[model samples]
Target chain A: MMSFSLIVGFFLLWEILCIALNVSDLILPRPSEIIVTLVTRFPVLWPHILQTLYSTLTGFVLGVIIGVSIGVLIGTSRVAYGVAYPLLVGFSSIPKVAVVPIFVLWFGSGTTPAILTAMVICVFPIVVNIATGLATTEPDLEDVLKTLGASKREILWNVGLPRTMPYFFASLKVAITLSFVGAVLSETVASNRGIGNVMMTASSNFQVSLVFAGLIVLALMGVALYAFFSFLESRVTGWATRGNDIAIT
Target chain B: MSMTSDISAPARPTAALQPATQPASRSNPVHPRPAIELQDASVVFGSGDKVVTALSPTTLRMARGDFLALVGPSGCGKSTILRLASNLIQPSSGIVLLGGREPAAKELRIGMAFQNPTMLPWLTIEKNVMLPLKIVEPFKRTFQQDKKGAYRDRVHALLAQVGLQDFAGHFPWQLSGGMLQRANLCRALIHDPDLLLLDEPFGALDQFTREELWQILQDLYLDRKPTVLLVTHDLREAGFLARRICVMSARPGRIISDKAVTMPQPRDIGVIYTPAFVEMTQGLRELIAQIRK
Candidate 1:
């Protein structure tokens, strides 16, 4: 309730500042104008919003699957970690925007390139988080399992996988937003659909209110997915983080 | 000293009478074998210039069902004995055997508990106790096929032994440290291993909690009778629980003394104040003090 009111107050202040400065619509549209554009352009904007959502969702899911697999593999084996970690770091360091052109050339300016870009951009964090989770198994706990004659595979399945869940869920919250950024970046550069493309077309035509409208829609989608994953994290991995609650109380 | 013995005199007569009937049980052809044997086994960590000897050709043996404690000052390589016995680390020299032979992969049957409870936080207490059954087999192979819920019953029974029957559905995080430690004990013993290894399993608990766990552990040991090897620095704890106490020297640790504890079974907390128990602790404490110097 408090956050909602604060956000409303901030937008009201922005509108007042715009009017007081006599800002032109071409330079900066009022929040009121953006809302009006959002409502009036809903029919035209809905398809673009749906397209971005579809591409981002597809890319995020694929990224999680591939990233978790690679993370587990690298986390469990020293040789694999040593061989793959540096390569992963170097690959992730390269700005994902730079790869948009290559993806567009290969996949030809559609949802495919957007999805591949999102997947590429979103996978690194999941892999890093899952790998860190697996790598940090308590040595005492490992000893307890080892003495029971558990094979490495058994330990990984029974203990390592469950241990990595909180980290995996945390990465989802971060990666979901990155997936949106990736999809939008690819769309603005090459795609003919999605909110990114709509924003690009609107800005070029000086429909600044529509551009702001697209950004609002993108942020709403990001927040919805972030809240969804946060809910899942609390429910599924509550035990891993319940210690913090005890400390706070 | 006579006054101390006078207080314990009544307990001894009954204890002496009870052992006479034990020979009949011993005469049975199913004689107990040595549970763990470390024959001149030495461990050295690292190699070349960085090499550090942890245990120096330590030879030790425990009769099946014996409760033995290893006590020494810090950095005395007491834990190396546990690591070697569990096959977690190979000894640099000599042989370490379990149940009269080199432990084969399938024959690896040992239960271990450590100072930290190490419970899987995601699992309920019942599930945590049942974890070993899913890994070590013959249970492992048939765990999925047990439609009768026999494994669940076994876990429940083990949890009941530790008085955690009511908390079986609770996750580890909800339980107190002492409760988690009890669950840790249940997890260790659920598979019915031939040997139980404890590395200061109650070290982290408070004095009162530690004493309470000592009784629980003693009851469980008496009930199951698995050969136990406990490594601890607490001499009083050693005297109270173990049938034999082995004192190790400083680094490159070797057994300096292995003394038999002749105190009878089902001993009480009151026994610690008895002159004989105090004498045993004093002797071991002196040995450790000398090694420290």
Candidate 2:
């Protein structure tokens, strides 16, 4: 599942080539040696992994709350939406990675800068999704409510917000994954700890095997976080699917 | 918007519009009424090149327990008239009154069935049917107190009447078009509105289902007798269900013919194949053709 055996197979092929060429172990340290190094260093790497996971999770949660709230506000009011939507679009188009140094300079390294970086890049999807869902409420249904003399507040609470949930949750899942990527990128530049810092140190010291392990952890973290959010998404949207009624005639 | 006029019936309460907007209220009919009235009202939407007159001014009165249908082609404004009567849009250049004098009463306990069925896709069928009562005050206040019993019983009863009893727990998508439309009908009528406006309620169903619903609708009308205004392009449906069908012309829609169907009560589907039924459908069809021209 980790694809380690495939790397082992490639190393075996490389080892055979090295033997034929009479290459030295010092020049191309045997794959077995790298494995020994990987095992020993993994213990050292554990704290770094924890640091990255903490920053990523915090960033994701903070970004999602702010994004979804703003999204709902923009989505509901036509006048506010018209005035502010273009600015949101412009902001979303900017490559957030380019602004990482600015955030680090302002927040001064560690989890704070990393979080600001992740949130900057990850909040747009929630806004766009919620706004679209709320904007397209069925006119017929609205008319029915109006004729019945329902207050605007009642219509919004009973209909508008309920209709927007599926889109909101979907964007949340995507945003969580993006937030993690943003955290890693931010850590690569400014963090003292975290997986990104270890990878940076390993590359500088030519510890390619340890660097490989760190990457594996990065991928695993992303997948695990994505899985976690997917489960949350399904649970949150269970009501939405049931409301759509796919069972009876 | 022009869309308003494009879909509503053009025949308005012209007689009322000609008189003062503050014209003396006509004496209430001696009979108890369903609570909807339009006095010489005309609705003109948009301006210049986009100008559309959905309904011409004409006095129209629908009493309680009356079952009426407006038969017209596309752009004839049948649905517009229903919207105006339901107070969805204000009538331009005329007065459209509801439930007599009280501004609050003027809103009328009105229900409407649209082609989309328009059920909130996220709510279950029972919840959708109970939707109107949740938001529309008096009912909203009453709904809070009767939380446990009122909605469930009423939703079940209405869906059962339309043969969706088992689907009370289902979502809108789980149901077929006919079933969804049936649910939508129940949703509109759930408030037990005194007046019901149906815009092509069965227009999207299969012929068999359409005919089947004719009886279901007839039964519903028989039971509740809400002052009903059905807007449709179907001549046979109008002939079968309505006590009176107002045939409307295209573009600037106006009532061209007011045909009364005196067919005996409880019009069973078998009566549809009768000679009298055939003649009536033909007559209505011809009236539409004349208007189309």
Candidate 3:
């Protein structure tokens, strides 16, 4: 439904601009011409889209796993939080997008650079969100466990992990979208193939609809990842869930 | 009830007598005797110019099924005593043998309910109560047997005892202070521990609710008869619930005075208005006052 609306919206704008000023085909291709190009170019673009999906998903999973572990570590331990938290905040503030070229230089073109870029870009929020969740554990629960002859493992497993889950799930959702963005950007700068590379090629050839198609694929991919995490949230939290409104953070 | 320590409990009196003196008798004719065998138990926080003795080298034996209350002023190490029992921190010197073992993970069948009644916000009241049974043993055997069925049955029974059978599905945040404290008792009792330690549990409750819980607790003790160490500032509660009230001094806390209050079973709230309850409350309050000085 969304893709149909987006297509219609793009066509209306494309047709209006093309007809009003009688614009040159090279400068702004007519909507019909763009559609024709999209059909003819689908076979070429499909593989690049797959490549980007692989890199983005790979990077996202890696980033979230590492981020959550670090977050839990820092959040639960005073020494770790003092050492790691400020550095994370500072590192997140730096323009991570600027490192796309550096990643390419180190890893050499194609998938590696794109995956590394996505992973780096995706980690900060997951760490911050998970850390906040772990730090915010109810003081009462901690005391109860301590007094009940519970070990550190028992407290972490029964109370700590379940308590911080909403945060972890929330951070994963954000990381999914950001990872795709990172993958596309890295593909644009360095990759031989990917949705980003396809979009760049489409724009150079004056295929506006094909560019829009690639953008549509990127949007759909992000949404699909979000939906996957949503399913996961329901599974993990069903035991202790209050209601349907599962606020991640 | 295996009598291991030979600390025999004086038999139930056929006719209630007016607070009989517990004849300084430590020796009881039983196999498994439980006496709080503390040789030189002490705790010193910091040192030198800032040296603080939270509890001095003192000795006292609280019998197995005794309702002992530690009453003192703020910062008087009343709470420190409860912590020492739970093995939250080891004493600087000496030991505390809970049923012949130094408070290991599973040796001492101990349960703690804090003042806040800190129920895990995530679990429902039923699930929270069932939690202790899942962790501690034999119940773990029951946990493995038809896990959900066993837990549900146990939870329901516990919730009923706390007058929270209808609210089993509710979260901790949804419950009021009175309900939470009731749930706290259910959680502590869920494991059926030999010892139940209370650290100013009702201190935060309003007077009415606190008194109501005291009555609820009196019945529980009469039924379960668990060895209870209750620390409280409210002399009325201490006087009403505890069989023996240990009045402690400020800082370097020690059992300065141990007074006994013998009241009948299932104590009614009407008893609080009676002259006997008032007199005992006043007497304990004076003892605390003298220690505070």
Model 1's CAPRI class is medium
lDDT of 2 by residue, A106-146 (tens): 87888898888788778899889888988987777677688
Put down candidate 1 lDDT per residue, B10-38, tens digits, no spaces. Answer: 33321211111222223334644467878
Judge candidate 1 at residue B62 and give its lDDT: 77
The full ranking of all candidates by lDDT, starting with the best, is: 1, 3, 2
TM-score of chain A of each: 0.96, 0.79, 0.84
User: What's the iRMSD of model 2?
Assistant: 1.8
Tens-place lDDT per residue, model 3, B55-121, is 9876766677778888888888888888888777788998877766777745667788888887887
- Go through the candidates in order and give each one's DockQ: 0.77, 0.57, 0.44
Worst 10 contiguous positions by lDDT, candidate 3 chain A:
A240-249
* Model 1, runs deviating above 4 Å: A243-249, B1-33, B106-108, B145-148
lDDT per residue as tens, model 2, B25-126:
243355443256666778898999998788788566666666777887898778778888877777886666776643355456778888878888778898
What TM-score results for chain B in every one of the models?
0.89, 0.85, 0.87
Clashes of 2: 19
lDDT of 3 by residue, A87-152 (tens): 998888878778988887888888998898889988999998888887899867877777676678
Candidate 1: deviation at residue A78, Å? 2.1
Q: List residue ranges in candidate 3 displaced over 4 A.
A: A1-44, A82-95, A98-107, A227-249, B1-25, B31-39, B46-53, B291-293
lDDT of 3 at B2: 15
Output the TM-score of candidate 3. Answer: 0.83
Instruction: Give the TM-score ranking, best first.
Output: 1, 3, 2
Clashing pairs for model 3 are B3-B32, B4-B31, B4-B32, B4-B33, B5-B32, B5-B33, B6-B30, B6-B32, B6-B33, B7-B33
